[model samples]
Target: KSFLSKIESYNITGKQWVGSESWITQAELASDERKNILQGAIGFALPQASIPGLREFLLSLKPSDEPQSDVIKAFWEKFFDCSFSPSNTSTMCNGTEDLRTVSSDYTDVTYFRAENNVYKAVYLVAYALHALLQCRNGSNPITGKSCVTRNEVRPDLVLEYIKYVNFTTQNGAKVFFDENGDSVAQYDLVNWQMKEDGSVEIVNIGQYDTSVPEGEKFKLKENTEIVWGGNSIQVPRSVCREPCPPGSRKAINKRKPVCCFDCFECPEGTISNQTSPECFVCPPEFWPNEKKDQCFPKPTEYLSYKEIMGALLTGFGCVGIFLSLLTSIIFLTHKETPIVKANNSELSFLLLFSLKLCFLCSLTFIGRPSEWSCMLRHTAFGITFVLCISCVLGKTIVVLMAFRATLPGSNVMKWFGPAQQRLSVLTFTLIQVVICIFWLTINPPFPKMNMKYYKEKIILECALGSAVGFWAVLGYIGLLAFLCFILAFLARKLPDSFNEAKLITFSMLIFCAVWITFIPAYVSSPGKFTVAVEIFAILASSFGLLACIFFPKCYIIIFRPEQNSKKHLMGKIPP
Candidate 1:
């Protein structure tokens, strides 16, 4: 009655329930209290000690109206004293039943009274006694008497039985002992769930076996089997920081655990590839791939005969070769004709042969770059073009001397004879040979991978070792062509019946134009396209020499038989 009196007078104030430093307020606390009380009333009702605290907590709500009073009365009616004594001192409600009284039957089992450890201990003692009884009858050799002493028991026999002890107890638990006498420990992972009425139940979620390897020892059910705290169903974490993502390396804090680290980006030419502890440099032959997290072998590039640009350049080079061959055949077939003979037929033959070699030299540039190809391609091209230009210079001098020898007092032809013509051609061609020999001996072209021109591909190409040497070879050829162009331009109006000065001038004009345009195109192009541009310039200039100089002569030799005679070619028309 005194406990009930304290509950009836107790009151709750907002200040008493207000939270000082958290989200929980007085209203939330009161609501939780009511929820616990209502849940308890529906299930098992409040225990004896909790009843007074619950009653006072409800009174603290301060109900003033009849509706509030009726609500409180209904809540109070749900809670009645249901405890029963063996003397029948308490009343038993219709819905209330004790778990012990509702069962059909109960059986006694050894597991309920004694745990598994007790069975293990009993088995250990029994094995020792059995071994003692068997070995107790054996007498010591020194005594020569029936020995019933406890010290006479064989320790080896006792230890042997204990190592292999295996049996099932009356409780159905299997008992076994290891050689070391240590019991293996295994445990069930439990999930504790709190009920709305402030009661807890442990759920067997999984198990851990010490006999298995460490990594495989613990196993759990699905995540849904465990209940998490607060409102989230996710597994809670207690990490110092989030894990670093890929393409970044972790800077571990030596003072903290491995999980705590700072993330930093991988440096250039290096990659982390994963959430790694450190970054590694890529191999020299490899470059960072598109994602920048991995290294891939760099693409090998060259002017290949199989590719589009290479095939096209090869076809053009073949065409130039065919044209030069056909022109040489026309000149050879008409070697006796005045037009062919008048141009110093031997020099013309040498020029056509050199032009054919020049066309074929461009073929070397259309294949994979190698040390041999790099050295041969440039040197062959330089030597062959010099030979062709020297022949042209020789023809220009012959034409000039022939026109001068026609004068009444001139003996220029006798001084600059065919021997002099051959000597001059050889001298001009030898100068280029010496230059190329020095160029190859000093700094020569070689195959190199051009990495900067294009990032995605490695340009497998010939790198000219000496810029000065390369330009010197080209400048010497240009100077000879310019001198021939000027001399031929001066003798363009010569009255010879088969003058070739005009044709030489026009061919040089086309040759200079092609090479001048080639410089900028070669400089601006990239990768395989640079090789393509060079091949195009070679074919263009070679074709210019072949077509402009010989196409007219080929037409005259094939169709104009009357013009081929020495009488008609010597400035004397048929009468």
Candidate 2:
């Protein structure tokens, strides 16, 4: 009581105070002024049990009762402040508060009973005496003769017997002391709850029994509500720092306790939980959320017709197809014109058809890649380009052969006539068809999810199952294009009224330049930009071939009809 009063004087009552068993007992007896300071404190006390007939024995006490000691009579007079005798009934203690009536000082009957340890000590001594004086047959166990008298009993002998005492009480409680002469540890968790009348009540909230196994020793009652310090119902925070939340880790402070730390957020692409000390890296197919608390599946990406780039490429492909068809229409309308008939008009029509196929093949590369589309995009690109190059090669050879036919006894025209031109185109295009077949049969292109390109998204692209097969297909197309460029370059100086070889040479130059630059650009492009680069290359090269080869013929046929006559074609009207 004096220590608590000193703590309260220091204004330190806000903190919880854990006290011994005597602390609560004195708090119950102390005045309200001295006890109210401990209203929200918690303490441990010896567990109390009901003593049989104890309440009735305390209530029946009287000063005039027979066989009452002088101590009992004197204590009764001091308690009631009056004397009592059987002879003088008028002066006897009456109308006064007794043990039967509840008062401010006496609340419950169990508190008045002897402490549990006292009963266990008395039983220990009784059991020890029983063993010490017990006789076996006609001799005592201690003396090995007649039963030993009380005079022969020694304090050391009694102490030795008390060390081994083990017995159970009538209340079914086991009583035994350890080697250190201390009983098993057991205590009741008590909380000092303040009532509305400004009185403190010690509530038994839980128990701690050392006799039980480890981890099972401390237990709280389910129905009891603990009263925290400052009469607050909520538990108070006692640590120096709060715990770190999810999506963050703890950084311990320098020269400080473990509880004191700072919270740092997890890095990108990783996540952390509330209890984990380190961040976890998300899997390749997953990405961390904004808060870094969890992982989610990554978004898939592909070149789609809905995006701006894909739409613009699609539109350009359509324009290329329209221009090719327009050129074809002009040639068909002016089929017998001198300019159309001068150049091999049959190969011109075939070349325009192949250019149209080249434009249409680029559309297949725009949508989400699939098994069939992946196979079709590369194969169609290779074969259509081969066909288109073969047509240009045929035209170049025809220009050279026409000039050779005019020479003295030159039979080149018959050897490389229209039949042979068609056979050459068929042979060159068929080689590409065979290569495509072998590529598909051996190791075809297939769709795959590319995860390494980006951390937060999946790139849906075509995987070249066999790098050798993909490169071979591209190499064959390059070979045909190079051959056409070489042939057209040699025949570019051939004399003719409408020299188509010069136009073929210029078109092949543009084709070679575009594809040559496309190699490095295609290899270096990333994500969906790779597909866009290939599409741009296709459109640029196809436009180059179409504009250089056919736009001049269409212009002269439509706007310069007089220059398209047979006299101009035979070079008679050129001067």
Candidate 3:
């Protein structure tokens, strides 16, 4: 106050230089340097010196000091009252537009206050800059240590600027993002430097690029190239993924990863991953689709040629037996080999039975599996097998006995007289019958369709229960007949008239040869040709019977009419 009082001492109409002399003289008179600070502090209370309504606010900071600081008389600017200022419009204070908006009464005074106002206008900015940057504070644009001039603005003012300063990019600048924090596109490196006048200049020497030593375009690393017009990116030279294994499938649109490719597998019943672009399933009738990847059961309709051949061969064997029976009967009737032989005529009966049995084998192919014939077919086949074997056994025993009788000093011939011969035949016949009954009782065959699989319809087949059973019977008969031929060969040494053995011997040989050859031929031939086996065998056996027995008798009866005597015709001899 003393210094301030002295400053007013010399000033009335003229402003004097009271700062140097008065401050010095006054500070010499004072005990502390507090006078200057106290005087300045109190200066905020003066009228016309105070900031608009700011005087009231500063006064409120020291209610008791109002009398000493002379703050009660401080002028209040109505515009600074905020209540009188337009709402939301005081924001224009940063620019000169607010003055233009002022009422006309204030226009005349603008020029008077303009110069001083300008100094005060930039004072806070400079103070903020200087304070923040630790530089000298002033109203000049150059007064601050750089950071683009700092000492010009106080720290508090800098803070205010930070809050209020709006930033916008100049034309040459652009915004970019570098995820790797490496290079900026075509932009030069910049560094801050303080000018002697306290302004900051960012010196741009040259463009920055680690891609080349100097002045070169950047080349990106692989997998680093952007895609889709900068919408995305991709890794280069990735490997593809393989498909799923067998018996599996993939869902639609299930995406594979970058390093993997999509693949699908066929399902359990359905084969997949075929020869084409996608997997395929096997059709119902055809097994193993295009994939050739899996196996499945084909329909019965697709049976192989061999299967069909087996069926036809079976059919032929049946027809042969039928014809054989007819021929045997014809021979018996013409030769007068009476069916009603008083005692056991089992040999005659077995031959007849064998022929009948063979006929029944053909019935197995009557139709597909049907209820009426179901059980009968198996029984018929079994019986047929027994009968054929029985026939061969009977013939064997007949040949053996005949030869024994012809042998010198061998009495087995008389022991097995006519009745004994018949009994021996019956023995084998009954034995075979018993065997068949036993076989059927132990293991019955069924033709019930297995719906799980397709229904198998037999087009051609043996009348036998099964092919194996049929062959088993043939094997037995063959072994027996082979032994019969050996016996007959020895028996042929006897007188031709007494033995008459060549007929049976040759017939048996022919029969054996036919069946044996038929088996192989049937196996090799297609099913369509299997019928030949039956027809040919029938014709051979029939002709053999006609030649062996009937033809000889017919020759005698026709050529030697007298030879058809009472004994030859009716009583005894084979005419």
Candidate 4:
């Protein structure tokens, strides 16, 4: 009833039948026509008689010669005609030949001899004979008669024979026991395969030899040899649910076995990489691929000069260089003019050179990062810009002191003369150079591969080893520009005929604006774009300085030559 209930639950509808008494003849058993009726169902019978008929009946249901169908057929064939029994008609024991012959008188009943009956009875008789021989004596010494004494017939003698019984059976089975008197467990792995005649036959796929080591015990043939149950080609599933594959983990079901569980995706930065119960983190310098099943080398990334953003920034740097060169030439050609001479042309020249250096330095930010380039690029940029701003500062101070000295009997002009202008420029530049030296000596920048910011790519960038040193460089330059801007603003209306302070103020304004906007953008930008933004700021500020201060002066020197002369601007001093 329980079997019927289970089959019904599984929707396995089939005809049901029963077997006769155990002692029934083959003809009597075959009398029931229902025994031959094939169906997808279960059967319950002893391993001795029913196996052969059951095998044939099940095979009749499967007309097709599929590998799995053959496997099912082989299972029954192996079960009925097993090597474990001594009465098996086959002339083989395991894989070895059986040479011993059975007596002809018992030939008809010999076929019914199972291992549980005939083989065990043979061992029992052999042990009894051994014990009897050991106990037998011609006569007892004290009794003086031919008799077997009870002292001679001992349990130890029989036990010794049974424990050490190592012999080959008539069926050619080499049987023995271990130290614990337990038989060696061995099993044959069988598979069903289709014969050439369109019939099913049994195949010895492999074996489990317990006498071998544990790892070498179970040996199965190639996967192609084994045909699983049912008509399907895949291996039969025993668990309640399918397994959790790679890149995922299992969530155990409280109501079922551990084999029955739900699968879940692994967490970020980790992977299972195979069917596993838990996930683990990938190694350093490696990242999970798209499937999260395995780790791979992280892809390197940087602002390459070949990319559009990099090319645009580089082109702008080139343009700045061209303009700076042109400006330097224009000033040098009109070096004797009063307007150019009065504005400290030497300082102007150095400032323009520094601007050129700034433009070129920005190019370093747009290429594959190297150790030397990373260290040199930022330090060089900071020092050069400081020099540029220093020149602007010197000019502002000279303009302020020159006008103040002309108004009264002041000796400020001598103190703030051309020589002092050169000294101040040198002193300011040397201070920046010293700061850069200290910064490099202490904790300098170096090339770094960063993986934390992005998941898929490695940002190949320059790491500022010390944040304080970096900010200090920027802060010092900012201070100098602020001072220059303030001084120039105060002296913007001071004798405009010979004053360059108005132009200096506007240039400083542009420079300050560029840097102020750069901070937030640099902070917000991700990956290589951050480098691009910094380069853009550098070019923008350098161009502002060049255009604001020099462009107007060049316009007047080249286009309006009369305005460049001293007589046109006789306002206060002896021009």
Candidate 5:
């Protein structure tokens, strides 16, 4: 009562109270003022079984009856505040109560005069003595005598018999002690439920018996409702921290219990759906969302025509095509002029056509790479460049042959006429065509999702299936360009009237310089920039060839008509 009064003074509420049998029994037996403080508390109690005739014996007590001993007389006088009398007319003490019936205050008691554990102990000792004195065939197996004398009995001997004693009590409950000399553990789960009258009731809500099977030892009444602390229906939590939520992990506090922890969100590119020690990394082609709870497929990236860079490159390619066609128109209109005729008009027109194809091929590299575009981009670039170089090579040879024809009895014109020039261009271009066909048939380029180039996105670019084949095409174009550059260099010093070789030499120099830098830039560039570098190389080289080779002739035919005359070609009218 004093301990419960201390708890009541603290005014602690909403906290579950649990205790052993003695602690709970004290709460149950406390005065109403003290017991009210423990309302809704839960605790364990030793399981009780009703004792036969014990309630009847307690109710049958009367003050008129003689006390059995001095202690009994004194207890009866003190409890009832009256002495025992044989001839009392009233059966109650002080004429206010009947001794034969129990008081209303003690009605909650289940048994009288004996505790459940005390009853079990009495039975345990009786069984041990019974087994100790038992004789078989006139011989006591324990002591090797008909009956063991009381003087021969010892506390250790009696205890040895008590260790193996097994019996059932009057309530049909099996009683036995374990090797540790302890009886089977049995407890009743009790809850202190408050009543409307401000009194508390100790209700048996569950049971726990060690004699039952392992998992079946503890059980609760399914229909029984538990009354939590502070008369609340919800069970109070005693944990130090709440659980970590999804998309997060538990970070344990140092020198604290495992229940006490902090939650940390998953890092970028990793995902988790529960309280885990670590997050899982997303796959190569996947990325984690903002919440880091789910993985999504990475966005595909390519040099699309819609983006600013691709649009700019496409615009440049279109300009190149338009300029090439416009140059062809100018050459056709001035075909009769000395400048156009002097520069070999047939090869000049063919070179413009091939330059237009080169510009158009760069457009193929601008869009999303597919199977057809992948194959066409590289093959078309190789073939068109070879054809363009072939035209230049033929023109360079013609300049040398024409200069030779001016000498006496040279006869070089018959060996290298217009038909031979066309055949030479055709033969050189046909070789590149065959090489492109074999490259496409053996190991062609194809579109691929490049994952290693970036962490958060997929690069949709053309993958060259055979590096050797790709490099071989570039090598073959380089071989033709080098040959053309050397031939043009040899003929550069010829007379200015018939010599277009100097312009060809300058065009080949720009072409070779652009491509020589292109190899290193293409190799070092990353993601979509690699394709941009290649397209820039193609556009720069094509523009160099167009400006260097034809711009001078168009100026002569359109702006300098006097210089386009036969006297200018024969060097007869020098300014």
Candidate 6:
């Protein structure tokens, strides 16, 4: 006992490795700094040590025999020997927290995730930690001193201990909380202010219990109780009418707090920004009036070449096709293109519908998108696409037929003629019509209701019919395009401009390229991009057709008077 007592005094009297014992002249006590450190360490360790499955730890030391080796030996010994030295090694247990449904016993409750709000999480953490701090204190076995976690709102009590809060900013006082049950911190954080209904969340701050048993990191749940006020304030969410996005004024009762304060508007000419933020505005060269917030094109170079010309060309083009078909029928004993009179009858139907295709393409420029106008536009675009491709296919078959007829015993002659051309056009058209019918039967293009749309009165709309229609349309177009490609390749060595066939082949190739590129471009964008896509499509494809089929007509009709013959429209074929 005497021999052991000699070393025990040395352990207490500053002979220990950490030098913490230096001021302990008395056998029973430690200095204030040492006491403070021990108090803090005790604050941390005592809670863990008392955990039912946790093994206890103790400080250990390494001893040396030589006096010269004391400094070197103490350095190595402290590094190696300083540890809790748990007694149990073999037994292992895992602890997982179990959450019980919080009782609605108290009035203090934040709204749950009905709206994806997180205010409840902050308060729950505050309440839980409140209970935990109380559950700790003198209840602990390690700290002999008495401590208390009361209901009092001390700086350290409710707010400071919270994990998600930003205590530094005035508005940051109690702005954030972990709403979901899962908080990485040992204690969850939250904000509670008297004035706020829901919490405005503070983000990017840290938590105390963020580490796991394995020392891995845990994610903080997204639902955190956040409040608005004090050092930091959040911008109030703005809800505005579309089209009248950022600049244009709402005519009558602007749906808002007051005079255009929360009115749904866009600047006169700008469109809504493509990526983020939900608002309305007109883009450059676009204008809207205060009375209706109707988006209209602003006068610019686009005026002569764009919206006006587009509307005029489209309107006149359909009319011209209808008129030409009428005139052709009048000349051919009251009906049909010459191809229909002979074995080439199928080509007549192709020609007729090709005229229809041009007419339909013109209808796309009817007016700004509304329920009725939008439907008309889609109908026009749909018919135009289907018929245009089918006509190209019909032309290709006719060219192939001309070559096949010269070869003896070739049944390709029987496979196609005027009747076959008629059959192909009628069949392809019926397929297209069926696609339209299916679309109309299912979810036909209609006005899509949006709560955030223009003044909540006008519905933002796009074609929302059967996906099958889109697929069918693309398939029909693609098949014809492939056939056109094959025809072009077959006719590669043929003399240019011998007949209109070369012009038709080149036109078909251009049309195929335009529609093929359109597939992905349309699919990748939102419905709002429909008008933009269609405008570009019409200009590209329609122009290709016009250049191939009508440029010579225009040149002759305008410049060469002798070439303009009434017999061109009224020529009677051999009876």
lDDT of 5 by residue, 1-575 (tens): 56667777886555677866667755344454544456678888887677666666655654345435666455555556665565364233342345444354333446422376687788888877877778787776755756655677777767878877878778756788887888788888988887765566678899998777899999997899898876778888888987766677778889899889998898777888754556889898899888777789999988989999999999999999999999999999888877888878999999999999999999989888899999999999999999999999999999999999999978989999999999999998898888888888999999999988788899999999889889988999999999999999998998866468999999999999999999999999999999999999999999999999988888877788888888878888883
RMSD of each candidate? 13.6, 6.4, 27.0, 12.7, 7.5, 27.9
lDDT of 6 at 312: 61
Index of the highest-TM-score prediction: 2
Each candidate's TM vs. the true structure?
0.64, 0.77, 0.38, 0.72, 0.68, 0.38
User: Model 6, 6: alpha-carbon shift in Å?
Assistant: 76
Question: Each candidate: what lDDT?
Answer: 0.69, 0.83, 0.44, 0.71, 0.83, 0.46
Put down candidate 1 lDDT per residue, 1-575, tens digits, no spaces.
Answer: 34323433462211111112121211222233233221211011111111113233433432233434665334322343342223265454333332223222121121111234554566676855554454334652323445445665566756655655566544434456556776454545544344665454444466555556789877775663565444234565657787666667789889988888898887777777655557787776787765568889888989898988788888888888888888888887778777888778888888999999998999999888999999999888888988888888888888898889989999989988889988988998899888988999999999998888765568898998887778888888888989999999999998756678999999999988988888899989988888888888888888888888888888778887768777776778852
Quote the positional error of residue 194 for candidate 6 in Å.
46
The sequence of per-residue lDDT tens digits that candidate 6 reaches over residues 1-575 is 34335545454422111112121111123233222221111011000111111111111222323335556344443343332223354222111111122222121123211111233344445654654454354562222324444554465444434543322211121223456534333422222222232222223222335434554443344664333322223523333434344343345455554434433545333434334234355443345555433456543211112466455655566556665465335334422322223213334344555755655555554444456654555655666666766666776666667666767877786777567776776787777777777766776666543323233133244545666766666676677667776775676554322234666667777877887787778676543344445556665776676566445444444465343443332333211
Task: Give the higher-TM-score candidate: 1 or 2.
Answer: 2
Candidate 1: Cα lDDT at 351: 91
- Kindly report which residue stretches of model 3 are placed more than 4 angstroms away from their true locations once superposed: 1-270, 273-297, 301-322, 325-329, 332-346, 365-414, 441-476, 497-499, 511-575
What lDDT score goes with residue 14 in model 2? 57
Model 1, TM vs. native: 0.64
Model 3 whole-model lDDT (C-alpha atoms):
0.44
Candidate 1 residue 382 Cα shift, in angstroms, is 0.5
C-alpha lDDT of residue 171 in model 4: 44
Whole-structure CA lDDT of model 4: 0.71
* Candidate 2 CA-lDDT value: 0.83
